[model samples]
Target: MIKLQKNVDCVLFSVPPILLLGPHLAPALLKAYAEDKGFRVVCYDPSPGIYSRLNSKEQEGWPYNNFEEVFKDKALLLEEVNLWLDEVFKYNPKIIGLSTHAWASKFFIEPISNEIRRRAPGVQIITGGPVALDLGIEWKQNGWVDHYVVGDGEEAFLELLSGGTNHPNIDGKIPVPISQEAFRALPEPDFSDSDVEYYKQKAKGNRLYLIGSRGCVFNCSFCNVPAMTQKYRYKDGVEFAREIMNAQERYNTNYIELADSITNAAPNEFRKMCHELIRLKEEKQLDPKIICFFRIRRAQITQEEDFALAAKAGICRLKIGVESGSFDVREHIGKKETNDDIFFSLEMCKKYGIKVNLLLIAGYINETEEMFQENLEFLREIKRRELDEAIEMVVVNELYISRRTPVFDFAKDTGVFDNIDPEDDLARDAWQTQLSNGEMLDPKIRRQRVHSLKKFVSENFVHLKNLLVFAADEKFSAETGS
Candidate 1:
């Protein structure tokens, strides 16, 4: 018999296929927002719980193993879902909200949603996040979910809790961006209901997540961020800094991962935040180390002093989305970083002793063999110049062709893709796609290129670790070891 928590209005779930390292940002953010609005909400993130039960082999394969593999094991998935359902019902809330990603929607979310419906017939079900925004209509049509919040959930979620429907961005209506004021007013995410200790131990530090902004300024071809978040908005510098301070003080963690599309998209706000962080370090004796995605802009706009300030403010690592090394290829993907810009950014980070992770894409719609060789030569140059010293990790991936991105439109317009069923949920393999230059940048070609790049990086730059090679097409190869 389950003993229900008194007066719980809503029970939130951070659905699986999420990283088990720390508390997920959406549930914690929504939990904070809802509770601040005087609703009694309890968030149940079962990722840590799920991770604890996995064997050593499964544990080692995590995140890279992904939701697809996990969901395939129906027995294991159901066993975990039943256990979670037992715990969830203990809260006996009037409504349930789930947060999921696009990748997890078809795999993890579908089955669990069905189970939830079967067990609790009367409780209203709501879902929001990237998955909800992308597939809300499909999920609703299938009767898997009652309500799905599309773009921003802060206001829509509140409206849903009050039994409001037919709102914009709700139930498959057009997306509505949250106001900057509302985004700013959002309180520090509450993570009290999570398995904080389990996450801390799993992460091997008190690492946590923080969000200072939403969306990206750049309209990269392969990215869906601009479409998803609607527009870029950020908190004030002092307010952002204070939120970090408050979270650190409450959670007893100095390490934070910024869940932003690009942390310095608003350079003025970024600078001010850095200054405030420096002040907090001095005045409050708080040393908060941060890891975030950063845009490698030109020197004129992004000065060297900015890196200096960032280092002082405890920005330990920056993940730069240098999707391609070739100038033309990068330009095609809407990344305008020149070789000089890349070198300057890397050299500056090296000067500041800040670690960087370079994110590269293997094969885009227009990548030719020559373009690939250009990419390889660029890597060779990095190794030759010992710029690899500044790099913590180099993440190489096969191009993921999502229908929601501009890249998909490019593929369709150019007659590059094979017959793709309109009903398929996840990003399909564009391996059959042929470039205008009569080059079939197929799976075998992409795999071989990725292997060659990995072999060079592994052999030459031993100190620089290579992160996940997201090859959605094939199994782990002996060369890359995934």
Candidate 2:
């Protein structure tokens, strides 16, 4: 169903609606791959369009409960859709690439695709990203896409650009590998995008994001990185330093957000990359600040020197995926790091003046009231420390069990299709879990606390309302001697 050879082999890559500062690096990387071989590559990003409308005055829906909520204002939705489709039609692309990173994006995909199909019935539609790869072929049958690159798309996309029709498929999905030759030739994303002015307005020329590696070394139960990439593949230290330099020089960017699943893979190599960046910074080649995702294994956490070096290299932020506060729950999720190790890592970041963001999860598979309280206490403990700007944020998100994750496997092992309905959209929310005993675990209590708890975590013990409320309440009760 691919319209591969429509006209001059132009590839139109686009990221779907929803906001995240700017366009993702996926399409840019695909553009780089295709352009290197002298193919015509075009782009159509919906982020600016989406952000403009959402932030516009008199916009009917400011805070949407769901995608349907925004669509409820039919006039607003249609206006945005028209603007988006106009951009798409500009290229008259033979092939179209859609970004499928978040499941929430599926909402916009349906409406957008319906419109695109109406406009260009013969266009070859391709989908790739985290969810597309994680769910595999079944994802393609969602009545939207005709083709999919269910793996690292850099090389596979290049092959497709070179006029190969037969895709690599296993169980009705194409999961192609980046050949060793292609791996060596992979280039940093081409960021001469149309949204440079938009990015500048958003973050003052610092909204750019890049990925040094793909896949995580740790396949946590709830994570989809391992299934998406199959295994960890990386760019070496020198190549990574070059990428940092290029992105900064070309984009005039101050902050570079590393979008790796876990940035510090293969410890020595990560250290080497940091040293290279430090050397580059000292030489005044590129003095760019960075934010990266990291894990807290013993080897990584115990080594303060590694983190200190990263701080010297200008890594300002580290987002740690600390799934749960309860050690038992954490171990169940295959997180081997202990509470002490996590604290030690935070202390090291603090020592080096690097800000930390602990990513927590609530309403996990089989989570109880007690465990949720433990999460609150964990947030409280972090607040109590008063590290004085060492902690940037604490994002306590709902745990959604996506395809190819251990949590999804657990759901299948428990009931498979008998109790859990894969096609049912409501069941897919992180708010619901189907227990093996046929009982359902819903996020009723969890949802009730999400707003207030998020508020408390963000503003508590800070210069805001309810300042140190936990400690203040404790002190007041103790002083009363009741």
Candidate 3:
């Protein structure tokens, strides 16, 4: 342990819950690292503080799903911001770190950041988020942010806290990727600070939120994974399973959510993990339903192999990035899964009695009416063949470019974002392609199509319709005004 530059070493803040704060693995891992390094770290979540003001007879269920959207109202945001200001001011720390990943954080963190600057001018405010590396000097000079980190946050944050030099600032963004060995050396999460009961209540049970790994192997063109996690890294199945069992015991939950982009990024390791989990379940008489995001390929989903082992090991649902039905569009975006691959994987999931959530993206850069039609036909084929029966829910989203995705680069290279100049070059909102036919793709149409598909899947899929609530409660508080 070395003497710190300031009294309190680091205060990390998590803002904007996707849904009442399921365990945030990032902060936990980072906190564990700081403790191991002999640093005093305080993990703060502002949701409960923000929740107090919103209490009412009807609004007592205040921190509902998508509750962060309520902050869009300026007055409402200030109410929450004031609460955060009180807590942050109480700490009066020298270093304040904000984590931003979800789209809401772009706007949601602003007011709190503003209040941080106003109250403590001397405090160094750092941010790690999507597009942080690309933020211009003007944006970084806005008083709220002293330095923004890019790639993995742990090393960059530790370096900043230790008063060590970081990467040469690209417009004041300190871009650094932690070494894989260092990442592997991170201690088990220390969630001693967070609201465990709140997480359990939000999960409505003893739901275990565990991370199988970080980073992704594939470079899907429209994916933001590459910018966030620089390379592929994962823990083997046995390691992941032991962690899961330990988390289940810790949280007292049978439902396990592996919060990885692709939990089975490593094939053989995944099999070993699955085998160990199945054996553990049998030995301990445990019934765990594992849910995690996955990337589907024909090789991984064979009849007597990965899918079978995963299903036997309590892999209830696998969220697969189906992307688009059009082979042309998928190929265009560098997604290796073919139409045959999609159906084949679904068949395997069905045979093994494992539910799958098909994650579809609409409107590629070169998307045409025919491309969407191809996707439409794919959905039709699935329904016509009753393959939709195997699916839990089909989440179709209107494609929006995320900053630093390959698609965004293509749009940038084509001068679509030229009006914003080189400064805002990575802004996904600036991505718009002018077709050779002299017409831009209407986003409204794509959005409409996505909504229509969502409705259709909800109403039509036989088994899937019944399992919708278990997948995600989109209407948990739709009319409650909470």
Error of 2 at 364 (Å): 2.3
Scored by lDDT, model 2 comes in at 0.66
lDDT of each: 0.80, 0.66, 0.68
How well is each residue in 193-243 modelled by candidate 2, as lDDT tens digits? Answer: 556656666655355788877767787898867776776777887778778
Error of 2 at 152 (Å): 1.3
Pitting candidate 1 against candidate 2, the one with the higher lDDT is 1
lDDT string for model 1 (366-431, tens) is 889999999989888887878888887777787877656888787777665556653353435634
Residue 357's lDDT in candidate 1: 83
lDDT tens readout by residue for model 3, 1-482: 22223355777787654345465666777778877888877767776555545546424444333445555578877766777766655655778877665644566656777777777778877776554655424346775677777777677677787876455432244344556676666677777767677766644534556776777888888887876777776775677788777766666664788878788777777888889898888887777888888787765444357787899999999898888889888987888777887887888888889888777776667777777788888988888878886887666656666666897778778876666653442344334566666757655555556655666666667666332211111332211100
**Which 10 consecutive residues of model 2 have the lowest summed lDDT?**
473-482
Model 3 TM-score is 0.84
